[model samples]
Target: MAMIDLTRGLRSHPVRPPASGIARRRSFWERIHLDPWLLGMLLLLMLAGLVVLYSASGQHLQVPIAQGVRFGVALTVMLVLAQFTPATFQRWAFPAYLAGVLMLVAVELIGDMGMGAQRWLVIPGVIRFQPSELMKLAMPMMVASYLCRRELPPRVRDLAVCGLLIGLPVVLIAKQPDLGTSLLVATAGVFVVLLAGLTWRFIAILALLATAALPLLWMNLHNYQRQRVLTFLDPNSDPLGSGWNIIQSTTAIGSGGLLGKGWLQGTQSQLEFLPERHTDFIVAVLGEEFGLVGMLAFLMLYLVIVMRGIVMAGGAQNTFGRLLAGSIILTFFIYVFVNVGMVSGILPVVGVPLPLVSFGGTSSVTLMAGFGILMAIHTHRRLLPR
Candidate 1:
């Protein structure tokens, strides 16, 4: 039903006179101040996430309430970011990107280490920052700013410059041993470049090159990374080792069958077999407890958000807005996909988290920030000439 409404909204002719009149007539809460449809969808998903997180996190009451507070904070950030114009974003794109790169450097030089990775930097009494998360937002903005400067469908020279912009941060993040972030950062930049009209032939060539480089990439992967791929291929071979996560997560999902084991009744999570049940593997918890029906309903909500994003991208008034919005939205979908795929044993596990649903402070805030930019693009469409 959400998809159907979005489809109809897309099909309707967008005349500015009525749109502006409607905007003027809207209540303070009804304006693009917050996209009504998107906000409604987010509220539903976040509420559901809270419920799932409660169960996933050992059914603790404080867990969902604390996440609700984080959701409130993240929502406030989104609202503040939404107030900015696309022009403001475009104006600041390069600086934001540059700052991200510099911070990633800082993280490398003096970042705190945790869980065997140098991905965080705590400022004594201040925030514990993750620059890679910032790159997830900045990379697309950088590529959009770069491509928006040139003609539609960039030249080879243009592509090379964009490649440098993308590769630098990706390499930096990967050096921090964060393959998940590196992949997402690269994906965000590449999507901007692709949407900005890099030709299909060039994309195909890049794909071929990447495929050819697979063996080299595999050779360069960390020992655990290679073990993950091997475990993906044959999880049973090392049931007590690297494959434990995949085997357990898949069991939770598969056993849920259709309707699920019922909320809070999941043996895998309640009994403590699933790792990261509140973060990357939360979907398995959802699958195990709520079953297929619940999962599909949640997915429908997710697709609604994606659809609205695509619509916003299509409606953007400028090249930069379009490219940035589209890249952010697609990158969001990919993030969710990577998380789910890894947990379900279809892909090698990386550090990716399920977007809004995953229990992580950094990723949840970053994703909401991107959506804030999306709202800015959609709502700030110039009033049609009277």
Candidate 2:
């Protein structure tokens, strides 16, 4: 009777499956350290971007085809990086950051000047790329690596060191006169600091300092940079010059109404009324052709990606993973917000592109690589002993 009672008790609770069995049950994506949800959303966004780019480029098949190639390359890079563990990324973070900073310094000394900014480094026929874009990923990785080793709610001394790490790259990038990338890099590093359980009092103090430094920042701006701010305040002041982009972009978006003019049918783009319709202002092209419904649908996709990122960050097993993932996703949100706001004429035209939707390779590749890190953080978590 005693033996029977014990057997009944043992049978009452089911046993957990062996870890090997769980490992075998992982899907192909899990085995490869990829997040299907995040990957699927990114692919969908890239496909949509190609479709819009086709129209924005006046039905140029070659343009979308080239962009497709870029997406393929970016996805490959993402997949390869995702295979790495978070610890691997933590190990490489400082060296990658140091290399990136060295490249930025190299750019300052001998960079290819184009469109009034010395932001690109050209190595003859080998490759031409922007170091500022590299800093976007490095910034978060570095700050997260730095803080994860220290205590949470970092002490003032630690914060100061983190600040110096962040400020160096920011100052270098800003010297490139690429305000958009500089601010993005700065935001990336700041996100990590904020995610490290920063006290609100410290945050407030930093905010006050930033506000006080605005005048100094303003004084250092180039004439064109200042002009962008003035134009944001009153675009109509230079109707045919600096204001043309905003004026035309707003017109494109407004004309789309609730159900857009239909794909490849926007007058603002097809008739050449809109400038930069394929790049920074691509959202205007989307709004003009897809209308309010399309815009909402597109934004809903972005919202889902951001939500998934938040979920992944919450699930991270360590501080480094959490901080890196959180900062990447938040910076991605800023990318969308700033581009859309600039196109809508609410913010200064800072040349930020809509993530995955803009017609460019460097930004797209950098963004996908960041997402790869997020996947590594989320998918490479170790199972607990049962």
Q: Give the best candidate by lDDT.
A: 2
lDDT per residue as tens, model 2, 279-321 = 9999999999999999999999999999999999999999999
The candidate that wins on TM-score is 2
RMSD of each: 5.6, 4.0
lDDT of each: 0.88, 0.93
Please write out the lDDT profile of model 1 over residues 196-302, one tens digit for every residue.
Answer: 77667888999999999999998889999899889989999999988899999999998898999998999999999999999999999999998889889888888
Give candidate 2's whole-model lDDT.
Answer: 0.93
In model 1, the worst 10-residue window by lDDT is 1-10
